[model samples]
Target: MYPNDGFRELERAECLRLLAKVPVGRIVHTRQALPAVVPLNFRLDDDGSVVVRISARSELVRAIDGSVVAFEADEIDAGAQSGWSVVVTGAAAVVTDPAACERLARTGPQSWAPSPQEVFVRIRPELVTGRQLVGGRTLYGVDLPS
Candidate 1:
């Protein structure tokens, strides 16, 4: 742990492990020349890529595909005052291969929307960062559950 702060940097493998435990994340991307964030459920691919399932016609699909974006997921316990957050930055691409799509349909995260047509967008994790709050009631000068 850091001598001053209760937050500890998580290793890349630990970040991916923590990411796998969570089901939802926020995708940060550009929308109409402005930055936007959308909360969505996702799954971690075997290679650590983030896979999101959304409606094929979703504006997000077009906005994020082939673009560089950030994906963030976190688990926080307000009562306990502790948790972890992981962020992955990478290029988002729509899964266009029929065979891969079929495979994802069988194994990927189920969509939250009732859309007849859905597409899988995979974000290749080029950069991953994470931190864990070793929480308590207080830490150093700050208040936390250390």
Candidate 2:
């Protein structure tokens, strides 16, 4: 059985599976020395890389490329008071290979914004971790040592 501390640690495989089911995720990166978060449409590639298609002019490309960034996606049930959150920390790189770019263009995540040109940013996950909140009831039901 897992721990009863209102959360369960998810394995790498489970985390990747959950990531695949979510369509939108937030990419956390540094901007002007401050944290910047952007909601993006993304897809998990066959190799488990987080791929996001963004406008070519987007400054995010310069801000995050060749840097360590955090990507997070989650599903929360307000009524059930339960949810799972997954975080992937890795290096973000702009795809520059002509062949790879062509393939990615064909199978795109499709930019949410209307852009004449777009590029793909691939985050090769170096660390994957997640937790599921599964004890909303248990925490409230337990008596406190007050």
Candidate 3:
């Protein structure tokens, strides 16, 4: 049998809660038949979906729509060498409905990039998983695993 791991799995509810604490994530998708990862500012919806603003002309607009994609967000403590990471995988759909778009635009994260960001894409998570590193006390009195 394998040795006990120091990482612990996070429950679904806890994963969502942790996701809510972060405003940015990396979205992985297919671009030109190759894998592509892009950073985006996003927000978590009540239904456990991730919403992000994209420009109409962005390549990701076409690459992600109607496709399955993975989104990852993490918080790391370099000094402590402990952190948590969350990955969400699901179908991504472009929000074309005017009413829905308007609602999301009002509540979604603001785009940090310079663009009109008129398009909104929603990733309805089918799988959400997270892991956190368990830490122990260090010589510096910091609670980090050696």
Candidate 4:
């Protein structure tokens, strides 16, 4: 039998740090009275938010804007038994500002999948949390004091 683990608070800054390094994450939001999770290539902004590029008409784009959303990023190394995960809950909006979008476009997302027009989405983090698993049994979490 496996042990039940408790969840801990993760620091805001640490969560951003881990998220910035991870290449991909799951962005979760509500749609049609249901929950939807989509894998996305994301870039972590300096202000503890995430920048993601998607297709202009993607369903996620429609559902995310002006809404509360959750974003999660994780990296696992089975060989070393070490891994880290970060979660950000916040409001999402479409980045329509030309200057900001240009700036984001410059850095580019770390991962690219087949898509149509490039759509830029930004998530302004209200809360962020993270945890790390090490040596198969040890779990360390960063507590972001509210």
Candidate 5:
């Protein structure tokens, strides 16, 4: 086996686990035919879906509704030079069901922004990928022959 580097690709289960621990992520979507990235707080559903709250008047409401988008979250320790990043690509949909919206409102992420977020958007992930760096190398636990 090759020399063990700290860098390694994370499995889907691990990726989702990391996402569950993060409260904030960037949502990448198309706005007016241009790419736009917005930082927001999010929650992970049991089924691996991402949920976020937005203001009714916010541009993201219209831009992300019924659209395909990318969502990313990461955590890094600069001192240790180790970190992990997770990216999720999926279709976003505005929650129009009153009952479902109510449930989300009670369980979804609470936004730090002053605006009153009344709209709940759900992103059903189609693809999920992640990578992590450990001890400045790309290897995990594989045993190498001398």
Candidate 6:
């Protein structure tokens, strides 16, 4: 049975490890009325941020720049009864600065579908938190436990 206590609060290294294994995450941003969540293919950098490539004209690219957004990724093993999830809240911006974009591109996140992804959106996490279901301990990794 799943632990009643809470999920395990994963450390930074552990969180990065989980992010590395997960390729896709839901990117949530405020879109006038409410929140918009979009699935994006991303890569976790050593600095603990998610790097994603998108077209300059894409809706997500336009909506996210200079705004705070949330990115979440998770993994599950049905047969093994194990799973983990991570949420990163941060400011997002367009890597329009040539140098910045080049530096971010080097990390090599799978582009956000289709071909010729022209723009890069970098989410520098201000608050990162995660949890793992292990040994029946439910530890919310956020600064404050849930």
Which residue pairs show collisions in model 5? 5-137, 5-138, 5-139, 6-137, 6-138, 6-139, 7-137, 7-138
Which candidate number has the best lDDT? 1
Per model, how many backbone clashes are there?
7, 0, 0, 4, 8, 5
TM-score of 1: 0.85
Give candidate 3's TM-score: 0.84
Q: Give lDDT: candidate 5, residue 59.
A: 76
* Local distance difference test, each candidate: 0.88, 0.84, 0.83, 0.78, 0.83, 0.77
List, residue by residue over 8-83, the lDDT tens digit for candidate 3. 7688899899999999999999999999999888999889999998887877888999999999998878678677
Q: How much is the lDDT of residue 12 in candidate 2?
A: 89
Cα lDDT tens digits for candidate 1, 23-123? 99999999999989999999999999999999889899999999999999999887888888889999999999999899999998899765998889999
The order by descending TM-score is: 2, 1, 3, 5, 6, 4
Name the runs in model 1 displaced over 4 angstroms: 1-6, 136-146
Task: Please give the distance, in angstroms, between residue 106's alpha carbon in candidate 6 and its true position after superposition.
Answer: 3.5
Q: What is the TM-score of each candidate against the true structure?
A: 0.85, 0.86, 0.84, 0.78, 0.82, 0.79
Q: Which is the winner by lDDT between candidate 4 and candidate 6? A: 4
The lowest-lDDT stretch of 10 consecutive residues in candidate 4 is: 1-10
Ranking by lDDT: 1, 2, 5, 3, 4, 6
lDDT of 6 by residue, 1-146 (tens): 12233556677678878888878899988887687899888888778888888887787777899998989998866556568878888999877788777777676675646566577778997878777766433333324335
Candidate 2, 81-121: lDDT as tens digits:
78788888899999999998898888858776768878899
Two-way TM-score contest, 2 vs 6, winner: 2
Q: For each candidate in turn, give its C-alpha RMSD to the true structure in angstroms.
A: 4.5, 4.4, 5.8, 5.3, 5.5, 4.4
